[model samples]
Target chain A: MVKINGKEHEAAGKTIAQLVLDGGYKPERVAVELNLDIVPKAKYNDTVVKDGDSVEIVGFVGGG
Target chain B: MIPSKEEMFAALAERHGTDMQKKLSEASVAVCGLGGLGSNISIALARAGVGRLHIIDFDKVDISNLNRQQYFPDQLGIPKTEALEQTLSRIAPYCHITADTVKLTPDNIPSMLKDEKFICEAFDKADQKAMLVNTVLETYPDKYIVAGSGMAGTFSANLIHTRRVAGRFYLCGDEVNGVAEGEGLFASRVLVCAAHQAHMIIRLISGETEC
Candidate 1:
């Protein structure tokens, strides 16, 4: 299991792209951080989340 | 007649307490993107007697922005930095406001934000917000960044609050409501999130970082 936003999730080996999709977040509207490091949008499809990884996905909106 | 600087300072000190007012008067902050969030946040900080502000934005005041942003009908077509500076000067005559009308990027952010220790991320687009947050996190390790997000729709104001994301980063808003979700951005909801950001900044300036 992996930790997403401090919660335990059954997503040990999923890519960041898959995690965002599973979480129902628009791929373009969210920013991901893995273990305190930012994951670029272009690299989300290739970067995978390990069992102990902690992810923070911050979804953004257009309005200020 | 406008109050003298000493009178204004005394009034603020009376309202905020002498110690907190001193900290606020000595503090400096940078606000990027003078939109609904940034404009309102800047106004709140100014009214609270923040000593200096570095305001940055490339856009101008458009008519549509009147729906939620803090701009007057007569100020349309002017650069946001200039308009906000004019407004702030009237609100807090002793407050120092430095404005730059340039589009911020990962390249220019470091140089532009070098002076202020506290940064407020108030950009409108999702990608731009991410870019600013990511750049600040990777570049300025010591400075604090307060960002706004998910403040859209007619959701309850109670949800629009602050969360400490990292050691020096704070996120404020509902965290779920978004204009991209087919909901609208109303003045009340947007100002609620902006108030949270302004309050968090005030707390940070007062050394109350734990939240």
Candidate 2:
């Protein structure tokens, strides 16, 4: 199981884009981190999550 | 008669204790983006006697900004940095303010925020917010960044809060609502988030680092 946003999940071997989609956040409005490193938006579809990886997906909302 | 600078400092010391007041007076903070969040945050920091404030913004005040931003109708068309500086000086007569009317980009952030230990991210765009946070985190590992996010709509004022995201990076907002959801920004709700950011910065300066 891989950890996403501090919770364990069966998301190993999946792309960051899938994780973001499964989490119900817009692709353009959020940023993803795979194993403590920022995953650029362009690489979301290419970067794959492995077991024991800690992922943090933070969403951004408009407004000051 | 208006009190002298020394008298104002004495009054603040009496209220906050001399040591804490001194700490505040010696601290320098950079408030990026003079919008609703930045405007309110700057005023709170200045009133607390924070020694210096570096305010940056390239936009001018418009009629639409009057609803949530701290600007007057007569000040419309004036650059936000200038308008906010004029307002802050009246509240804290002795507070030193450096206002810049320029758009901040990745290349300029380093020099703009080099001397500030506390950085406030108050931009209105999600991409800009992320850019500032990422740049500062990567460029200045030791600096503390207090950012605002998701402060829109008519939700409960108590829903707004400050949370420590990662080491030395704190975020203030509901974390759920977004203006994209069709909920417009309200002054009351926006001000609540701004207060959270301001209070968090003050806590950091006072050695109370825990969020």
Candidate 3:
């Protein structure tokens, strides 16, 4: 199981883009950080998760 | 009589110990984006007696900004840096501030923050915030950057969190919310997030870096 936002999940063979959708975040609204480096929006479909790989998903808020 | 610069700064930092006071007085911070977060963060830092503040922003004050930004009605139509400098000087006379009315990008960030060990990223857009954070991490690997995200709308105030996202990067906000089309921004929530950045800068400069 791979970790998404610090929680374990079974996401074998799925691309980061798919994981972002599965996690209920809109593709355009969210930013994905695989391991430590940020995954550019263009590469979301190309990047995949491995077991124990940490992921962090964050979004922008309105106002300041 | 108004005290001298040194005397005023000392008075402002009087309650905090010598170490903290000295650290604050000697520290220089670059506060980017003088919007809601930048406005509050810079003012907070000034009140805390940070020595030199490099306030950068290129936008002019608009009426729409009154909802959550720290500008008054009389200051509308003026550049953010100018208005912020005027306000900061009135309230926090001891703070030595350099207001640069220039649009900051990944390229200018290094020069803007060259002498700063602490940076407060207060941009309004996610892309801008991400750009600044990424550039800073790549360039100023040793400097600490305090950024806020997911601070929009009027929701669970407790959800706003300040956590260390990387070795030298700290993030503050709910971490899940965004600017939904109809979602409204609460002034208090925005300021709550701003306070996190301000407090983090203070704590970091004071040698209390753990939390």
lDDT values for all models? 0.89, 0.89, 0.82
The residue pairs that clash in candidate 3, if any, are none
Whole-model lDDT for model 3 versus the true structure? 0.82
Summarize candidate 3's per-residue lDDT along B43-117 as a digit string, tens digits: 898888888899999999999898888899999999999999998998778778899999888678878778889
Count steric clashes of candidate 2. Answer: 0
lDDT tens digits, residue span A1-64, model 1: 7989889998987999999999887786676788867677678889988888999888776779
In candidate 1, position A48 carries an lDDT of: 87
* Backbone N/Cα/C clashes per model: 0, 0, 0
Q: What would the per-residue lDDT of candidate 2 be over residues B1-211, giving only the tens digit for each residue? A: 7799899999999999999999999999999998899999999999999999999999999999999999999999999998998899899988888998999988999998999999999999887887787778777868998989888888898889898776777889998787777889989999999999999999999998889
**Model 2 Cα lDDT, one tens digit per residue, A44-63:** 89999999999988787888
Candidate 3: which stretches are off by over 4 Å? Answer: A11-49
Q: Write the per-residue lDDT of candidate 1 for residues B53-172, one digit (tens) a residue.
A: 999999999998999999999999999898999999999989999999999998999899998989999998887887888778777878988999989898799988898876787899
Scanning candidate 2 chain B in windows of ten residues, the lowest lDDT window is B132-141
